[model samples]
Target: MEDGTKFRNIADLDIADYLDKDQFARVLNNATSIELESGQTLFEQGMPARAFFLLLEGSVKLTRLSPDGNEKVIDLIHPGQTFAEAVIFNGGPGFPVNAVVLSPSHLVSIDAAAYLDVLYDSPKACLDIMARISQRLHWLVNEVDRLTLHNATYRLVSYLLDQTAGASDESCDVCLSAPKHVIASRLSIKPETLSRTLKRLSDSGLVEIQKDHVVLKEIGALKKLIQLETDHFPCTDKKNTLAVEIH
Candidate 1:
């Protein structure tokens, strides 16, 4: 897809609501669109930072490559999410991690300097950018908490339970954002370990994994098995706030 079409697709997403039509058009005009095949590197750690990416289609994996040549997957980003926003202002170092396309993907890359200009020109855009950064930080913290559990089974089950919040109860189906190994890396577990954990969940009658879709047979029991404590994390109430800000 061209950069303009990719920007329009992004504009259709909820996150792009904060941008005005003119600003959005200017951003699209300044961005470069690229097509990446599976396993293509989008950016690497320690390289000069120049742009931030907005995923238009397919998935990208953000990973930190260790000195010993090991890779730790930090995040799996899908459509509508912006990556490397932190690099826009820091100007300290290049991307602290590597981003690679997990499948054939389309992305819109906005020059960091141009983006900063837009932010300075529009107060509302600045606030929206701040909110996005804050939201991403919050998610990273929560992901850390989820991975702190000692058992792989607990982590896998907890992940499934987390997916249920935005899911349809009648369908009880949730799509896996990436392949099993990629998700395993994100959870800091071996692929075999993830497979074993899934088998255990199935054996316990908690869920049924078919292809990339996990069908929840007993969500209540699965919640109980994971010992979920909902009170610890308050749900966000952004209906009116988002409506007013984006519109």
Candidate 2:
């Protein structure tokens, strides 16, 4: 499907910002544009990785199927961002996750081989690409750390605190862009547990859930709560170790 057409939206995306005119044109010439409706899956986990994409509009979720037949949310991609980038370097394999459109989306899919070919002549472009991949890798590492080293409440609170830190206004509001279950999966907790955590925060005057977003009413309390949860988490692991001494 690569008939050498122009992808006009490339100029505004961060991926294109690193590419020079010739470099940009090369990718466009080797790319295919796609439009898909909500609930459409672009690719499945373990599917061959022949291409990557720049989302021109709408939201997308990258998820993986766990061994227990459950799905885990890996990331939520926004407009102007790229996804499936790591697959290009995955080396002789398939995509690590499934890419599903959350809303009607416009995307430009660039052939992996063509994109890699252009990088050889552009050191800066290569570095930019690696940075994006590395950032995702870092997030994955932190995700593992969060899942294993803390409780569900601790995870949810930390998630809210992070969202609040990234907010642009003083309201300290966090938006729930995905379904509650999806968000819960991302935090490694159940949907019911997420609701209960939110309810408890609301009851304690620490947060207000008006609709789709949460307002952090007392930022200081949340900070303290997160620390308390971390330090005083049920001592199951520590308790096992102390069993010999106590007995």
Candidate 3:
């Protein structure tokens, strides 16, 4: 997994979206690979920002620790996504939050200087990165608006509808890729509240909750329930954007 050749073969990286083959190869050639077991720390909050990581395999959770030691889960970085790209250009030289391995994972740590150099050398690549950062900022604004203005049920229902986007079938399966509590934190809902909301949805015949998967029984009805809210607060496929590094 550490080999540059191995990195090249993973289509999920999709480096070609922004960089050409030659540029992509150069970046990987300069990258240093790091592997971690589940629950291991990748970097800590306030650590000097020296590198930006690409998750080659598995999942990583980005979290912020409060002064009193409370943890807020900001995002779950999945494979095929890059995290902390903004750190490369930030005026401050430290990470704003901590990243931990959600499962056994392989990551490529691209030196900040090397990445910056490539961006400087390629206008197209630099613009691509900036556009991604802009999109993420917009998404965060939408997320905050949803959390503050919407109720728990609205938020949870919106989340469930979002999961079924782009599906051909009327029904879709959503796997809770992380623990329930972690997903609750990401949604800014109390764990018990999330449980109650799911139970209500199940009782009403909207969705069926298995151990870790939620099967939408009536997708159209669920979507219609939230249509008005979604009209005002549009929810994009945040995952598809590929540049969010929320801490």
Candidate 4:
């Protein structure tokens, strides 16, 4: 993966842009890449946080098991995104959730100690990392506000709008990063509720579903719906902005 230009093009490795080529090479040298099959556990909660990971391909679910043995899906990480980042610095030296592959996946593991050493050597790189983390924190705060203030229908609609924020065409295809049940868990709703919401939106001519893909037929109407809700709820960054791309 470190074949010169190939590494620089990876969207998840945008951090390379902040460093000189030599510094980027040092960052790459300290990392190891591996492939895993579906149902594999990448890491577990409470384990020593020796490293953080980048999802080069496929998806991974970050989940925490509750006291009653129920699993709460925190997030479904997409390709070109990193997870367990907070553990290396902001949080303690332990993973707060379990990262399990939802499909056959490729990942790059960067040793925390080595990566931190590189960060300390470059002030600009450190500031860039902080900015990225701050973006994520903002998204998380909005996510919490969304969950607490909105109903299932509003949350689902808002999520659909967020996913299609950058699409250029009138209609766009959206595939769930994980399964329906996993997505429902992340949205804090039951699978049945998600199905119902999709059906409701489809009946209203907003979206159409084909197998696992949701073709958004009415992007304008969807945006208007979210806008109407935003007027009532009043979020800071309704457009998703840099927080969405920080993945």
Model 1: lDDT to the true structure: 0.75
Better of 1 and 4 by lDDT: 4
lDDT per residue, candidate 4, 15-109, as tens digits?
Answer: 56677777777767888877899999999988999888988788999999999999999988887787887789965758989999999998888
lDDT tens digits, residues 1-247, model 2? 4443344446777877779989988888888889999999999988899999988777889998878987889887877778887767858579988999888898888899999999988899989888877887898898788777777767887788876655542348777767788888878778888898788777777789978899988887777666755566344564222211110
Runs in model 2 with CA error above 4 Å? Answer: 1-10, 164-169, 219-224, 227-247
Worst 10 residues of 2 by lDDT: 238-247
Best by lDDT: 4
TM-score, predicted candidate 1 vs. hidden true structure = 0.83
lDDT for predicted candidate 3 compared with the true structure: 0.77
- Between prediction 3 and prediction 4, which has the larger lDDT? 4
Please list the C-alpha lDDT of all candidates, in the order they appear: 0.75, 0.78, 0.77, 0.79
Error of 1 at 35 (Å): 0.9
TM-score of 4: 0.88
Candidate 3, superposed: residue stretches over 4 Å from native:
1-14, 230-247
For model 4, the superposed segments whose C-alpha errors exceed 4 Å read 1-8, 233-247
**Superposition error at 222 for model 3 (Å):** 2.2
Task: Look at candidate 4 and tell me the lDDT of residue 102.
Answer: 96
Candidate 4 residue pairs in clash (backbone atoms < 3 Å): none
Cα lDDT tens digits, model 1, 50-148, are 888888788999999788988889988887778887986887868888999998998878888877887889998888878878987898887787777
| RMSD for each of the candidates | 9.2, 6.2, 7.1, 6.4
Per-prediction TM-score, please? 0.83, 0.78, 0.85, 0.88
Worst 10 residues of 1 by lDDT: 238-247
